[model samples]
Target: MNSIFLKAVRNIKTLQYFPTNVVRACGATKSLHTTNVRNDLMEFFDIKKNWNETNIRVGRAWKLDELRIKSNTDLHKLWYVLLKERNMLLTMEQECYEKMNLFPNPERIDKVKESMDNIEKVIRERNIAYYQLETGETGERPVEDVVNLVGLQEKYEKKEYHIPRFMNTRWVQSYLDHGLFNSMAIKKFYRLYREKQHNEERKARNRDMNHVIQLIKRFPDMDMEKLKAEYPNVDIEKAKRSRKSRGHYVPKY
Candidate 1:
């Protein structure tokens, strides 16, 4: 009977220990889960203390080199964090502006924008590198030089071709016949363009010469070196030969 009683006691003790172990595990798991949730929430936004502050102090932006070393998942999470922070700052700024109050530290917006740009640049660099490694080509849209109707060369981005270049009749006819458009009008346009450019240059030269002549007339003892330094484009020797440059005083010789 004592043996059976002892066996019952042992079984009861075992059962009690099992529940204690389960309870401890459940408590630990709960604590860990709460911690993880708190961290996630904290990381997604700024600290709670900064919520109502007029001027929130922040450090410099994340450098491209620093971000490049981080893993892709880390970068992705950081982007969303920055994006939310930017939106919040913008909202606060707009509110302050509406209230006719000064928005402290306006440079913060510029810093955040710069950081976002750097992040995108780094991502593009990585993408290009990966593409080059895999496909032996830079994965970007191709650009080409083409002449426009105005007879000026311009850059045009090439697109995918379904029809071959020679098969397009409209494109071929446009470039083949220059006489289809009035050749006289083109010549007249070119002549006017050249005349406008020449007039501007002539006016600039005359203005410089007149200014130099006035300077000489006003300051008879002015330093020639200073005049040359001030107007590098004006030829001092040619100015000396001008009738306006001759002083009214008679020659002593």
Candidate 2:
């Protein structure tokens, strides 16, 4: 009889706890149903309401002057915002192409890019100014005129490398003997290149001379000073002696 009473009390306790557990579970489910699920990445996209629209209007990019007034901290934060906006716009554009739908306001991407470019420009200006003030030099890479392997001049930006100049086999080979540019074949090619350049210049000069002659033939009373100003390279007196410059009605000086 005592064992039966103990069993009955245990059942009573289970009955009491069972309802509370069920109620707690039910409340948890209800809370879950009421809660909102957020996706941060999708925030890069425009709002859902505008997603299917054919056209989405947006304002112009951030101007340089406007950015100039902003503090560096604010500009830094704004850069991220513009970057995110650009990424979102690109994503949307790609999706639109994939779906065969038109990307609304394609210029929005341009605006974002322009804004980012302006931000970079402002930052560079600040960096340059800071460097000038502190070190009497701009923080930008220094560029100098360098003769390339083919005997052409190029603007070379000086860069620092871990290796020494002598260790760079490729550079030494290109600039020194046994290189293509140092070979007889390259010398012939360079000669031909110079000839071609000379031929083009000669042709251009002849064409200009002929054109000036025609102008003189057509307008006999044209201002010689103006003609000289326009075609300073042409020998106007020499062109006047040409048979073409003697127009049908003109013996007029």
Candidate 3:
């Protein structure tokens, strides 16, 4: 008898809480922060008005400068809100693809990502500041230049080791007898790699010189001061000396 009474009360409460129109509205979604039913699965869908709309215009993303002004507590709250918004947008995108519908305002996802990135940047800046104030070092992991087996430079994060290099025979052996970088082939590869890098630099320098000569031929009375400032690496005098820089009209230089 008690169970029957409890069931009847629950049915009445459901009807009173969710009317026919309100229940139908639950099928559509808006911001969970604005809605009373945050845990509802239907929150993944777009609002009823936007469901059939061709355009869903939104503003620009949060800039790093704007985010930096916000407090940490506000940032933490906003992070979760953006996370929920991303979840809803992803769900709607997938649904649209499955149903062969045009996804509206797809760039909103990028804006949300940009905002989240700014938040992370602000947090990282705060952490770095706090750590530098307390200790003389940044809290970020220490990274240093290291050479790989291919003799290429790489940024390697330092790891904590329980033992020293001398005590760790296996670690020492990895860099000595068994290391691929210690081979004659690796040395040859490094030499070839260096030659390729130098060749690229030389080509770039020649291109800059040729471009400057062409500029001198084309625009004889162009701003010499501005040109010098633009290409500090290229000597304008050498370009003016070039025969290619000679045009129908003589250069001002």
Candidate 4:
């Protein structure tokens, strides 16, 4: 298994998975060392150990803090390493499932995914910082609230284009010629959608009010502070004053 790890690591440079341009973009130079890989299907299938064994050993997933400390080049390499590991784990799992065998330590998949996610987070942080320093803005895609064709407000992620919307004939034709937004059906849909949303909000408010009243009635000496914390919208004092909140018990004077 250890030898397999080395083989996979060595094979990464030769597999053409990381193109020269991409590696250079990561500020990584080509590794001086080179070794031959079998270049076989076993690369994906048999890389992971303990496929049939109950006791398996592997290191913990990469933590966000740990990954953040590593250089971009190291992260670039680690990302691909995790990517290959993930691919092998999925392939092994599928083969095991098809063969009616239980996959050992399915949590390995989650570990790889978490590591990849952390690495991405670190990369994104570095990117945003670099962009802010260099260009006075985060390099992430610009997003804004935009009304869709259906009249509902939604997030619109802007895309790069060679021409502006008004100048783009295809875009202009599709949006301007098709008066979908002005149709009676669309207005009716927008009206009904807004009404449905408002109705749900109202029902939820009433339900919370009724539930608070019940709690007040049942547990007269209950922890009102905790109840208030849980349902911040419920008016505890108002619920206490409500007729339904009065207990159905006669006090022994």
Model 3 bad stretches (over 4 Å): 1-33, 36-56, 87-109, 161-170, 250-253
Candidates 3 and 4 compared: the better one by lDDT is 3
Compose the digit string of candidate 2's lDDT tens values, residues 18-52: 86555464577455434345578786677798889
Between candidates 1 and 4, the TM-score winner: 4
Residue 99, candidate 2: alpha-carbon lDDT = 91
Write model 3 residue lDDT over 7-61, tens digit each, in one string.
Answer: 9888777868877634445663343334366667878877778887779988999
Once model 2 is optimally superposed onto the true structure by TM-score, how far is the C-alpha of residue 198 displaced, in angstroms? 9.7
- Cα lDDT computed for each candidate against the true fold: 0.77, 0.86, 0.87, 0.84
Error of 2 at 202 (Å): 11
Candidate 1 whole-model C-alpha lDDT, 0 to 1: 0.77
Deviating ranges (above 4 Å) for candidate 4: 1-38, 46-49, 53-61, 104-107, 199-218, 241-253
Q: What lDDT score is found at residue 140 in candidate 1? A: 78
Q: Rank the candidates by TM-score, best first.
A: 3, 4, 2, 1
Clashing pairs in 3: none
Q: TM-score for model 1? A: 0.49
| Candidates arranged by lDDT, highest first | 3, 2, 4, 1
Worst 10 residues of 2 by lDDT: 29-38
lDDT of 2 at 131: 99
Model 4 agreement with the true structure over 41-63: per-residue lDDT tens digits: 88788544466586567789999
* Model 2: residues with Cα > 4 Å off, grouped in runs: 1-39, 148-152, 183-253
Question: Residue 247 in model 1: shift from native, Å?
Answer: 24
Residue 32 C-alpha lDDT in model 3: 32
